[model samples]
Target: MISKSTIDTVFETARVEEVIGDFVQLKRSGSNLKGLSPFTDERTPSFMVSPVKQIWKDFSSGKGGNVVAFLMEHEHFTYPEAIRYLAKKYGIEIEETQQSDEQKEQANERESMYLVSEYASKFFQHSLLETDEGKAIGLSYFKERGFTSETIKKFDLGYSPDKWDAFTNKARDDGYKLEYLEKTGLTIVKEDKKFDRFKGRVMFPIHSMSGRVLGFGGRILNNTKKAAKYLNSPESDIYHKSKVLYGIYHAKQAISKEDNCYLVEGYTDVIQFFQSGIENTVSSSGTALTPEQIRLINRLTKNITVLFDGDAAGTRASLRGIDLILEQGMNVKVCPFPEGEDPDSFARANSEEEIREFLEENSQDFIKYKASLLMDEAKNDPVKKAGLIRDMVNSIAKIPDNIQQEVYLQECSRIMDISDEVLYATLAQIQNKEVPSSSRQGKQKMEVVREKPVTTPKVDQLYILERNIIKILMLYGNEVEDFEDLLLKQNDDTGELILEPDVQQSKVFEKVFLDLQEDEIAFSNEDFRELYQVLINRLNTGEEFEIGNVVNELEPSQSKEITDILMQEEQYELHSWDRHDIPVKKKEQAVNQYVTQTILNLRRHLIDRKLQELLEGIRTAETEDERTDIKNEVVGFNKLRTLLSERLGRVM
Candidate 1:
């Protein structure tokens, strides 16, 4: 319901790089920026952003769009919600348009759940800051943890009263359906009875990376043996534990800026680290690591340091996650707290410098951590020792980079006192082997399948000539000058050489390229065709074409092509470093260079064949006049060839 003007203001004010950089750690790639794919787990950067285009594209996911689309895709926000988010971020005043009650009633269940969750977050925050019990318990708990009032407001910390049906009755009175309340896990309903889900607990709302409240994690204040220490919102439509990382919304910028992520296991662990001046930290929330979670971190950093609880079981359980990180091409290091300590306790005990120093000194490669922990169990037992070596080799094989994998293998060999060759051989075998016999058979069949051949129509010479014209248009479509050319015409009464004034063209590219533009000029791939059309549209609109915008619009495969085209090479050198430092040719000079060369090359090939025909006719001449004419034509053709070759810079 936000006004269009407000939306435009937000879009214009919000810098694409700045907004995306909150989640993506971007590095300069020529005129654009590149980063690891956020939509997929990747070690290498395949996601691109163009400040000029104000858009982004993930080459691995084949999803490209403007800032709004990224928010929608990454956070699963409805269009309205995304606009509202931008408006809030940019401090724009949102003026809602009138909507019919009937139209408003048509909102879907998922959207209703989002609405309910948002309302619940606000209600809890209000309760915490505005009520006595909440102030004494929830506010005090946060203040005791060193969270300032601004930080508390920033995170929207909240409290739910001991009254069970307080939230439920309030929501019902507000016209939010009970179904949505249950769907968002904010209210529990049983056999004609409804009550709040987190009553009597201090609230910590978990947010998606886009800052939408997905769920909540609540802590019980009163010590009671009958009550659980902590409770979380059950899996709902918007919150998937395996895919969501707590504190990511707040910590993403710090994580990306540092180029490293600190992975912890609990909500408090993340908050404490941030409070202690370590802001690049997120929690898995005690869940086993998932690929989706790994990709989320991968988008911001290629390096991750896991802080494990000092307990032996906690360390062993977290060791498996290292392989997942390795598979995604991330550099992982492990830091184990002292016995019986977690990140929360450890941070509370030391100063920021002390905590940092401890991490720096103790963080070791995952392979080394695994070997160090497991080697003792296998000591003096040959079978167990061999088994441990194989386990390390398997973990090494999961690494995508050859150099990194080899390095890990060498380290493993040294640590286990095994031969390096043996470890290498084992890793190679593990990598080459298929997942299973059935899967291998299916893959082999796919590899053996051959494509059928098809004939294609030959392009007319004019078509090739036109293609050259299109290429020129794509390269230099914004020229502000005109080009002049000679034109020949025949008078009505007599055929003769005539000179006429030819109006200078604004841009030869726009005139010629658009003249030949057709909706039917299809590409083999739809995405390529889509990208080509977008490029043409941008050129026709007299706007500066952005290769990143096209990349964002195209499929992932086609996006790679667009990115490669824009970033492949400089394509033209401005000036060479030499004595006197002469400047490169001006725009007009560059255009003329391209145009004159192409025209002359085409003319040379055409005339060279014609000259051969003229010489052949000299041998077949039946009359002296014909022979003389043929000789004259041959001389003229040779002269034309010489002129063209010179213009084209070719020795003929």
Candidate 2:
């Protein structure tokens, strides 16, 4: 376990840009920095880093948090892992109690294996680019398959030389541990001899979601019947073929944002689709789909569209994996390629829009396509058609949702020309056949699938307002600004009423705190309310407000929330401004405008709520005095709201 003191020092010393710069190439932009997002494949620089606040934000994916949060998001590191990474970078000593030798040895071994794999990957890439044999063979093979140089680099595609001991000799010369090399499957040691496992092949490094190299998959270049066409790293401590999906490290964010995952059978298919601008795709690494791999996609989304190869026999062979997906309660769609075409070849041939449109137009629900596929085998035969019905019913019985089960059953009736009653009877029989209690896996119920994925809904106004208030407090709370208070006046000559702005100078925090008290308004969000109290209490003392100090003391989630609020460039979360009216200005120049507008907006909301309360009180009045009192209160709120509306230039 890491000590609290060490965590504080790491946060204090870790520079967001410096650490992130190690991974992402950042260029200076005004007071901050900008770069293409490491978390996404982008053509422009949309990721931002604020050196002043020690935080980063990715506008491409809409994920922003502090430095440790960047590692957790970009690298998929656990909290402690991120902390330790930062500590090591900043040269901070972690104070943890000594552990058992077994525990320490296990942790060190895993890390050493990861390091060895990383070295091997880099070595292979260097060979692919720098060596004569690699370029003539491995690089030529990739270019022939229509992969670009940038695509090759992005996936770290590499080549292992044909010589038996080339890689092993290089790794040993570099002082890499022999045991680690053997464990990571980079070097095979047997009978007091050493040789590279992936020699004479083009290598594809398998990565974890955080981009750590876990293993490799190599494709042999020669036509040798004695050797397998493809070789994968054997199941080791870190690399489990059944548990990891290829390309998941790069495909995770797109899968979540699109709420859809394209399941294919090979690495090249995933790479081709990604190059074609469909980033939400992964492969099963030529292995059967396992529950653990399904669970990985389920963590990001429930929908999976399995892209089938053009070969009919290959398509038939993959149906068992689809059935496994159905049993796991995942929504499944299937799209079969035309004869003589697969995803790798088809994606290489098609443009991005054409490929996307094809997927949208051609993908069918699992039930429809499976029946169409099995019907080819039935061929108007009495016995085979019966078998088709039985097959469809068995797949339907795997579905856990009652509505989905009924809908698919009805669909089967329509397609097979069988009665719905007969289909339901067959389904019941299949579901009722009981196995041993210990052997049965309970199925989980999932919601019905949507026709299209929905983007996140807009956050409500109250949340936006509260976020604004705390944001202002965290950023400009101690900075002195001149605020305008709208005052009403009446002219004696024409009896015309007018509003005047009475200007006064005060710290931004004092005006917000005192004005909120004058109206007795409190934050609706519990966390905001607590943080507001903390900022106010600290600022109330005649001392400078240090945000870093406050953040260090808070829980991680709370600190991240406040950090996001503080580092935001756009302050008007609720108000979408027009350039013709209130043009965008630097935060320094817009402080008074924003502070006044936020307070006025908060007042307007609270006054409207108070007016509603008073109106309800009038409805339940017991006597004329109570009704009169409520009406007077409502009238006063309405007048004040009208003034606030005039100041904010927004009708309440």
lDDT of each: 0.76, 0.82
Show where candidate 1 strays beyond 4 Å.
Answer: 144-146, 223-226, 432-434, 438-478, 485-503, 507-510, 513-652
Query: Clash pairs of candidate 1?
Result: 62-556, 64-552
Off by over 4 Å in 2: 1-107, 435-652
Global Cα lDDT for candidate 2: 0.82
For candidate 2, the 10 contiguous residues with the lowest summed lDDT are 441-450
User: In angstroms, how far off is 494's CA in candidate 1?
Assistant: 13
Tell how far residue 12 is off in model 2, in angstroms: 7.7
Instruction: For candidate 2, write residues 321-428 as lDDT tens digits.
Output: 888888767799998888898899999889999899889998999999999888888988999999988999999998877988999999989988899999998888
